[model samples]
Target: METFFSNQKQTLSRAFCLSAAVICLGATNNAWALFSDDEARKAILDLRKSLATTQLELQGEIDKLKADNAELRGKIEGLEKQGEDISSSQKTYYQDLDTRLGNFEPRTATIEGVSGTVQPNEKKAYDDALKAFQAGNLKKADEAFSAFANKYPKSPYLPLALYWGGNSKYANKDYAGSISQLQSLIKRYPNHPRIPAAMVTLGSSQLESGNKIAAKKTFNEIIAKYPDTDAAKDAHQLIAATK
Candidate 1:
């Protein structure tokens, strides 16, 4: 009976130790699971923070690039405008230079049914003389016309200058000078458009110089050659007055 009791006690003690070991193992497994869950949560939070930081960096870079691109575009536009202004200025400068050059160059022009190449200085001289004559400065006109005739002897303006010079001389009451110029014109350019008018002046100059015989001869010649001209009528009147 005593030995049976002793075996029973030993079996009870073994069961108690096994129960304690199972309890300890279960507690250790639960603690490990809790630690693993905390570590996984921390890793997820860290990953999320890193992603947010990376996103912020990328956005900052994008903004900087955009600003840079805008600045570059503005610079390009400014350069283009500067280039256009430079081009315009160059064009204006060249045009002004060309106009200045044109003044010194010879050009084709027509004056009193005479077309030819005329130098700028030559045209200005002729125009100034003609302007003086038209302004009724008789002495200046005579001098200018005489100078022009002597200076540009081969000029197409010679005939007109001589004609005006003769008239100016006559207006100045220089009858001898008038006679000389008119006679020269009549002899040199007999078929000139101013011949009839010049001959009338010649006849009047002769009469004024107390040469009635020559004046009468000139009047008859005018009536014979240019009978329908106004100068011929003037000559007829002068002849009647002399009579």
Candidate 2:
């Protein structure tokens, strides 16, 4: 059989072993809890970093899109303005063309203190005849004026045309033709403003044609009809020369 002291010593050794086992288990559990907390904090930090980076990327993309959109809008506006300007320029160009074309159409006009309806080519005809006459193209002027008289019988330029044609004949030294034209004009337009000038031309043409008696008669008639006028002055000088 065992002694009592030996039994007591064994009981104390068993209690101490049990207490050491409990303390070791408690320390292991505390160490495991601290490790889990540290892992959770590290995971949270990594997740926050990922979120921040994603947000920055998203914001950068949005900013780029906004910039691209603004540039596209500006280009669109510029194209629209350019289109409008082209349209306006085309309109202006057409309007100018229309105005320029309208100039060629016939319209009523006053010529040589005479108001009358002129044809499309009437003014040009008269101007061409007058230009020919002024340029000393006497035959051309006569033919042109004669054609004008025959073409436009009731033209307001009739009296003037006949008058210039007679002058053209005179300048061409066609004394008989000049006298015929001047006499016809006198008989046709008795109250014409060009009568005195016509008489002067007729008398001068008669004198140049060696018809002194006819020339003297014409000058006397002019002096009787238009006294103190330029025609009368010319006639007085002629009559004195003839005498």
Candidate 3:
């Protein structure tokens, strides 16, 4: 019986020791599992931080690209405006140059039933004399026309100038000068359009200068040459009155 009790005690002690060892191993396993869980959580947090930092860098790059694009667009707009201004200025310059160049060019003109190419200077000189006549400055007109006739002896305006100069002299009561101009015009341009008027002026000038005989002969010549015309009628009246 004592030996049996001893064996029972030994078995109980062995069982107790095995139970304690199993408890220790279970505690150590629990600690190891907790440590593993903490490490996994820390790793997740580090990954989240890395993602946030990368997102921030991407956003910064996007903003910088947008800013650069806007600046480039503004520069392009400014360059376009400058190019337009340069084009406009060039057009204006060319237009001004063309206008200035047109002044010295010869042009076609029709003067006193004569179509011809007239130089700018020649046309201006003739127009100036005509302007003087139209302004009623008869003396200046006469001088200008006479100078033109002397300067441009072969000008087509010669016949008209002679006629106007003679009339200008008559208006100034320069009867001898008028007669001289009229006679020269008649001798030079016998078939001129001012012939009838020149004949009348000559006859009137002769009558005023106390040469009724010459006036009568001129009036008879007009009646014979230009019959049934107004000048002929005027000549008839003058001849009857003078006789």
Q: What is each predicted model's overall lDDT from 0 to 1? A: 0.87, 0.88, 0.83
- lDDT value for candidate 3? 0.83
Candidate 2 deviation (Cα RMSD): 12.2
What RMSD, rounded to one decimal, does every model reach?
11.5, 12.2, 12.0
Candidate 2 TM-score over all chains jointly: 0.54
Between candidates 1 and 3, name the one with more favorable lDDT. 1
lDDT of 2 at 77: 100
Candidate 3 per-residue lDDT, tens place, 1-243, comes to 999999999999999999999999999999999999999999999999999999999999999999999999999999999999999999999989865654577656556664556554665677788899889999998898888778766666777777788877777788788789989988987877677778887788888777889899989888888886787888888876566
lDDT of 3 at 31: 99
Worst 10 residues of 1 by lDDT: 111-120
Model 3 residue 204 lDDT score: 80
Give TM per candidate: 0.54, 0.54, 0.52
Rank by TM-score (best first) = 1, 2, 3
Q: Show where candidate 1 strays beyond 4 Å.
A: 1-103, 106-117
- Candidate 2 local lDDT, 155-181, one digit each (tens): 778889989999999999999999999
